[model samples]
Target chain A: MPTMTDEQVRAHLTHEEDLSLLHEVSMKTAGVSRLEMCIQCGSCGGSCPSGMDMDHTPRMVFAMLRAGMRDEVLQSNTPWVCVSCYHCVVRCPQNVHITDVMYTLKAMAIREKKYRDVAAPEFAETFVEMVEKYGRSYEFGLATRHYLKHAPLRMVGMAAMGLGMLRKGRMSMKPRTIKGMDQLTAILNKAKEMELT
Target chain B: MSAYTFYPGCAMESNAKAYYTSLMAVAKPLGINLEEIEDWNCCGATEYVGMNLIPAYSLIARNLALAAKMGNKTVLSPCSACYLNLAKADHYMTERPALGEKVNEALAAGGLHYQPGSLDIRHLLDVLINDIGLDNLKAKVVRPLKGLRVAPYMGCMVPRPDYNNRWSDAEHPVELVEVLQAIGAEVVDFPGAATCCGGHMTQIGPETAFELIRRLISSAERSQADIMVTVCPMCQVNVDAYQGETNRHFGTNYQMPIVFFTQLVGLALGFPPDKLGFGTEITSTEKALARIGVDIPKPTEDTPHKQAGLPMPSCLRKNAKGKVQHAEKEAA
Candidate 1:
């Protein structure tokens, strides 16, 4: 894959629509009024655990939202770094829905296919694969796929560690399939439709 | 006279058979009827929703739909992953009508329709603590796990705030702690009770999962817990079955028996070793049970107290002073 340019990524305008939907949903679901409560305080950025990894801190994302800088915010790598630990939400003085906003932003970013690097996309891909396969998050499979996709060479080290687990019956080579897997596939399709729309 | 629709999920029948066996063994004595829902399926465990939220919730909702159809007010699940999936679906459906509609639409194909809030989704610990009542449990403890220190691990799914099913603070859940105390077990206040055990991550990426599992085990070890008690099979398997690998990966020596809450209940209920599936455990609970003076004899068909309606065991009778008085008030 070629290095995605700013203009190439900026052409995708659907993320703003996603943000709007997220805003609407967040308000209805969580009673979180993120759009109104943000005061440009920079508190969310200060408390972010992965702040250094982002080009724009969480607070900046909020600031950009206020400024209507849709393309810049959508194209940035900030949202993917958020681990969703809720630390920022707990520390926010204004009680902004920083984490929810981050999730929404990440979801939008994912939908737009504007991820700057492979990490977030790989993580999301592995997460979806686990759900599709097992109808639930298989943490072992998820971690393995994620590492294998993002950092291929890491597999050798992982294999060495897994060998010990394999011997002790901790790790199973075959994924356990749930009964009525077809019904589960139908559920995933419906969920995908809702998420896509 | 209390009965609940049971959703055993996949793990309870297979890898977590001990949890299922112990649960069945202990329930009848407490007069709690766990009627397995007919033609039940998996609850999508923890990963399904992460990958695709709609189907994951829908798959879980299918079980909830069956439970609702049976007209059982409370649907009890012993597995944490199943409990979380069911609870998350129920909560999300009630909270988000649009999402609920989408999920219901998916379920419509299967001829299943779930009306959110029609059924109460509860974890086994929730039933034991809320419905069964601690007073009754305290009265029935023939074996108080006194000398054995236990770390209560709730894992990630059961205590989260998502589906409004959480009974305690998500960060610091106390249902397990309260139950352990009722069984006369020493409950250790340990961190990571609500942390993820990396669930299915052990299969996908052993190194990452090991690191996460190591953190939880080490925290429990630091708190001086003799064993870890969990409500989820994934947690039990990851923590118990994977301890040796986790130890090898991290170069740490930690041998802690990970047991189901139901197994602990079985021990407290005076069930013998084989009945509670004690021998199946990787780390021996024999030493821990021995500390509590519960030297269960070898499995035998004609044990002295095999009959169902004998007066509570002598140890329990001694502790029953408080329980009988409480039961009398309720009866009145």
Candidate 2:
């Protein structure tokens, strides 16, 4: 992760590029405007289920945005903490588009190599890989791969659990792929082209 | 009669076979012809859009392109994730001209072009309530689910604030509840109906997934719902099959039967329990079915409903508050 002083963090946060992307995606998807509408009210912070676990509360993130602390905002562990529950969005008096902002910031953080933890992003990657390969999520494969990638030792315990499930017929060993793999491949490639540009 | 281009997604074929089976069984009685789009692909499920926006939307839009070409004005998706992706892509394309241009360019390579707003993408539940008309549905009841209490869980993807396709309030959507009641099932106004089931997260991070699932199931149990009815196969699998593991991980005991909306509809339509795919469920739907006096029979080849050619019952006619009027008014 990129390290920066308070002044540098503030400078990066205020930078035009950082703010522009955040503004763009929000307006494009949620029709939310004015990140400045946040009044630092505690409604969003209070309602967030994971608020206490967050280093920077949703309210604080908005405050930081107003202060133009782009680098600190991007590097902070705040964005990843949001569970996308829309609780903040529902309760926010300003309708400040908290979730969309978090999404954009996380994307920026990932692009800038400033993310704090790899858990959520890694999970997302595993999901994309499944779609790229099979055109669908292979549950058994995803479960095994997730453990193998994130917590290798957990596989031993999961294996025992898998055996138990197998005996009871709760789990299936065979992985199922979606029909029309070639068509799916073409779609994925098209998606990739858009991402590249 | 209603005709829709169908995007089954992947789960319908494998993990959620019961959902597909029940959907096919019940739809025929309602005169819903779900013509599958030819040469269709996955909607990238729940995760791809989060990882990469353009590719994810492109991936979803490819299916929409095919549905549009098949000359179907409406696309009905059984999976919540697929419904969300298709709706989101359609919303974004109409709202964002530049992105629409870029995606159209990509589709052009496949000899396809999607006109934004050319197709109305909807979930199966949306079609049932908005198109099939609950009043008409209420009249077709060969059997009514009078005593069974069900919590209608919409999961995450279907009703969020996206472009204008949001059919109900994002936090508390009761459209499914209204449909369940039309079928004579007691619908519970549960708290976690709109909660995420940790979806594909169950595979990538079981710990996080466990906590999320625990919260949802516990809430449903507390709400006193006997079984939870879902529109998404992914949600059904996560809540139905993984609840035991979630309980074990959290040291709590929950024996909730997670069922598809179609299965409950099938039961209410007087279809036998076996025909509704009740035997395949991890948690016994038998007791719930028994509550409504439905007996489980041996699995056999699904027989089509005898009452096939009847005109849609009067109650099913579009109401003034109906979705068709609402969309048409908006268009006018």
Candidate 3:
């Protein structure tokens, strides 16, 4: 057997060993998440307006996190269903940062490609692309591209509303790129590089 | 006039044009000077954060850096999402040094750096209620919206996770109701006042959004509200632009007109309906305005022909299945 250095062995073990899912999420979140303080009181699930739509309530998801069901937790639609309303965050008995944790979960899911639905991820990707490109969101471009790619049939249904918006000059024909595009791009690129590391 | 660095979010330039128009008309009369930030960028809304952290924080921080550079102490955002994103970034960066350092590193590339907590981030509603004062607003009302009944929908972002402890209550804030009452309008007891408006779920999960939208409209209709007054552009757009689709999905006709609170403020301040961006909402506000003796010109263009689509069968069937499952479990 090839002799492995202590540093290499520790690194291998760290990669192989499963860190507590709760710890991973809490670390990823900004500020004091206090996710580990959750007592699974079901307030988060009960408070969520989109709770019914979620495959698992946030309370249940936290329980699953404790059980280290990484795939099931990450693949669940609960994170995507979260609208970041912060109702649960405010109502949590443990004062857990529920909404911030949800954001962290979403980022992790997107990074791991473990999300359940493409629609939410795709829409977010498109929105981010526009913000990155023009430094402004082009509603006209976002709706057109999203609808064409995901729901062409619904685009027909949406035409009237689209036309109304267009007539009212609500939807711009072209995006307004910021004058400091180079600066913004450079900042974004640096941020992107830092994010990967 | 007290000056503020205005961050007109991306929505303000587009679908929420009415909000922009009305706000501009009312700001001067209210003794407020809204200085548009020079070359302000998007706040990344709710999406960019879900994709990456540093970039999302940096995107918002860039705007903050610019506002700081412009020597503005207060940054005012009308859009709820923008307000939350900006406040959240400022709060988190200040609370967590590692994040602040990383964000500043990225910002340094563009010659931008935000000193966390250097600026006071506030929502438009907050300013109208706190700075402008209800008493001052009441005094300026040239035309009282006495007969019009409006549901004060504050949406989710402005109140919750309030970093500065500005709002009274997160769950059921009285600020919107107070503002509407100040303008001499009847404020309905709206239960869905702080409920989620489904956000981008309308695009990603139409069925889910339709149900959430249905609940809000049903409650407002139950209260016999003439219109829903909202402080957030996303709330107005979701409840107004998607009302028709929500109705179609649920097989219910709900012609609930949603308007920006700023538009109503402009009206009470005696600005003409056209100037306040009336008739811009997808749900026509003609009948609602008629209640208060305000006659606005009808939109000249003919309504586009709508393509008929079948009602969403799965959502309906899913409700039925849920009932059956609950019954079975109870029996077991």
- Top candidate when judged by lDDT against the true structure: 3
Question: Could you give candidate 1's per-residue lDDT for residues B171-192 as a string of tens digits?
Answer: 6778888998899888998887
- Return the DockQ of model 2: 0.19
How well is each residue in A1-197 modelled by candidate 3, as lDDT tens digits? 89999998887566545547778888778777899999989999999998998999999888777767789888999988898899999999998999888888889999999987788888999999998999999787788889999899998777667666765567665678999989999998999887522
DockQ for model 1? 0.11
Show the lowest summed lDDT stretch of 10 residues, model 1 chain B. Answer: B299-308
Off by over 4 Å in 1: A1-192, B162-166, B196-212, B282-287, B293-332
Q: Please give, as one word, the docking class of candidate 1.
A: incorrect
**Which one is best on TM-score?**
3
Model 1 / residue A116 / CA error / Å: 7.6
Colliding pairs, model 2? A13-A69, A13-A70, A13-A71, A191-B55, B135-B315, B136-B315, B136-B316
Please write out the lDDT profile of model 3 over residues B182-244, one tens digit for every residue.
Answer: 999999989999998999888888888888899999999999999999988888889999998
lDDT of 1 by residue, A141-160 (tens): 65566777666775655453
Question: Each model's number of backbone clashes?
Answer: 18, 7, 0
Q: What are the candidates' interface root-mean-square deviations?
A: 11.0, 9.9, 7.1
